[model samples]
Target: MGRFGKLETDVHIKASASKFHEILHKRTHRISNVSTDKVHGVDLLEGEWGEVGSIICWRYFHDGKARVTKERIEAVDKQNNSITFTVIEGDLTEKYKSFKFNIQCIPKEKGSVIHWVLEYEKLHDEIPDSHSMLQFCVEMSKDIDAHLMEGSEEPYHNDISGQKCEALSINKSKKRHVWHCLIFLGLNQNTMGRFGKLETDVHIRASASKLHEIYHERTHHISNVSTDKVHGVDLLEGKWGEVGSIICWRYFQDGKARIAKEKIEAVDKENNLITFTVIEGDLMEKYKSFKFKMQFIPKEKGSVIHWVLEYEKLHDDIPDSHTMLQLCVDVAKDIDAHLMEGSEEP
Candidate 1:
């Protein structure tokens, strides 16, 4: 093979072409969760995500080796239903002088076809083409397709506008197919949707101890800081900051008021960590189980607030807890500002 060559492959997807294309470009960050086996994480390095010329870092596994790459979004053409990325640094640069990835979603009668193209120039003739990397991308596409199709309101159809959907592929058919697949895999449908663990880190100008105190000891006061999101919190059992304490929280999300009854599962003052497990309230209606862990790490200048969410959905139709993670970050930001203002007072 020549030092310069191209690798191409196509994937048949059950998801609509427009939706697949939109996800490939607009929701690139979410691919890591959808294809966790291949993609460990994606982080925005420069510019805004999903925009042309933005830079993103990818941590993935390829050929049984952990790999990392930083690529810049070179093109996003909605008219062609395609997006392109050019590798600027990281592992691939060691062997390849240049590497570029392009993905196009083509609408078809039955479903859609995802076409992946890899253009690269090897450093030397001895270096091999990156067929393995191309294969990895193909598998990731299938994972993304399955994720988009799961719990979607629209039936599988070629129309991008989503006005013309096939009635035969509606919710009933999708549910039956899912049940059949679970049966074949010897899995229980009721216990199967326990799917995601999401983590977020927010850096703030507040001290770790102060932040920890707010969540562990003075949680009821959070409504005063984040007035819009948190209406109030009441202690149901035990004392604040004590393990086994039960609390009820009234919050607003998705433009609606919601409530959650949570118990203090653990408290690690030494590490500035506290854990809460939801036992009752509105969240339980959609989730079989939900839990939250907050840890504050002290730094030279400020602190880092880390939030981890472990949740199990009642069914695949229930969305992942990305919004809840956003809520935690928002609350942290609000509290950080409140503490900074207090310190400035003479």
Candidate 2:
């Protein structure tokens, strides 16, 4: 009769269980395929990988001779996030009576705990302990973890778009950032009217309805003014009184006029902030492309109004859009003045 022997070790890793699982799935074969010398070629045969009932065969040099082992995945449970491998057939069958390896993962605060279980029976009573194999597994786990943490040098699909937009602090809980790129269409020079775009992150300290009221009054008051020296009526309309509303404006330039529109993109009443997006109108027609976003943030002492504009110039002579930016800043200042004066009517 063959007597079973067992060895167990637990290692706590500084990565989440999900991360550990990802590492294991991507880099387990490095542990299974081992070579004794540089001259020896070692490789693992695979079929139906990372699933129950899968099989893996390893071939490598051992004691100056070729050795092979066939392993079968006995069980796999993604919910529990565990797997077990049993040696089904191998050249070492005569030397080792039985062998089984099990790995279990548990989620922890900042990382995960990996439990390794190994069991084997030897043909001879004097057979030595497989401490080297256990050491090999532990070291390989660390290698895989390092690889995953560092990540691959090759760019991923998400990176194709470009690096993530960096965050900027506009307030304690609010952030803002900008994104600008020069495409084949033209350069993003201020003179070209194709300046950079702005994205605002805002957190407000007031209710949604109050913030909406402020946004409506401020935008309406500004649109009513003449954009250029020419006299034209720039009217704003849509779900005029509520969040998720739309506003359109017509501005006179020269003898003719142009129309632009904006849509309420996001609203958080609890946070007292509203974000609006430019969906349609004359701005898009004048520029090859144009879009903007605006956000209103209410604070305990006062509130901040954020504005972002993205546009491409239609011609090289248009000049940069600093005038538009100044217009926005002026509006913000006006609103601030009104708020400080305790006036709700703008």
Q: Assess every candidate by TM-score.
A: 0.51, 0.37
Model 1, residue 343: distance off in Å is 5.1
Over the stretch 1-346, how does candidate 2's per-residue lDDT look in tens digits?
A: 1134454545555545666664344334443322123112212344555666766664544545666666677887777767888876766564556677787777866456666777777655445435445544545555544444565521122111111222222211212211111112123223322343433222323333444565654456544332342122233554543556777755544346666677666665555455556668656655665655455555564444556656766665554343454445444444444545655554
Name the top lDDT candidate: 1
Total backbone collisions for each predicted model: 0, 4
lDDT of each: 0.74, 0.50
Displacement of residue 120 (Cα, Å) in model 2 is 1.4
Q: By TM-score, who's the top model here?
A: 1
- The C-alpha stretches of model 1 lying farther than 4 A from their native spots are 1-140, 143-193, 343-346
Tens-digit lDDT track for model 1 on 30-72?
A: 6776788998767777788689998888878998998888888
Once model 2 is optimally superposed onto the true structure by TM-score, how far is the C-alpha of residue 117 displaced, in angstroms? 0.2
Q: Which ten residues in a row have the lowest lDDT in candidate 1?
A: 177-186
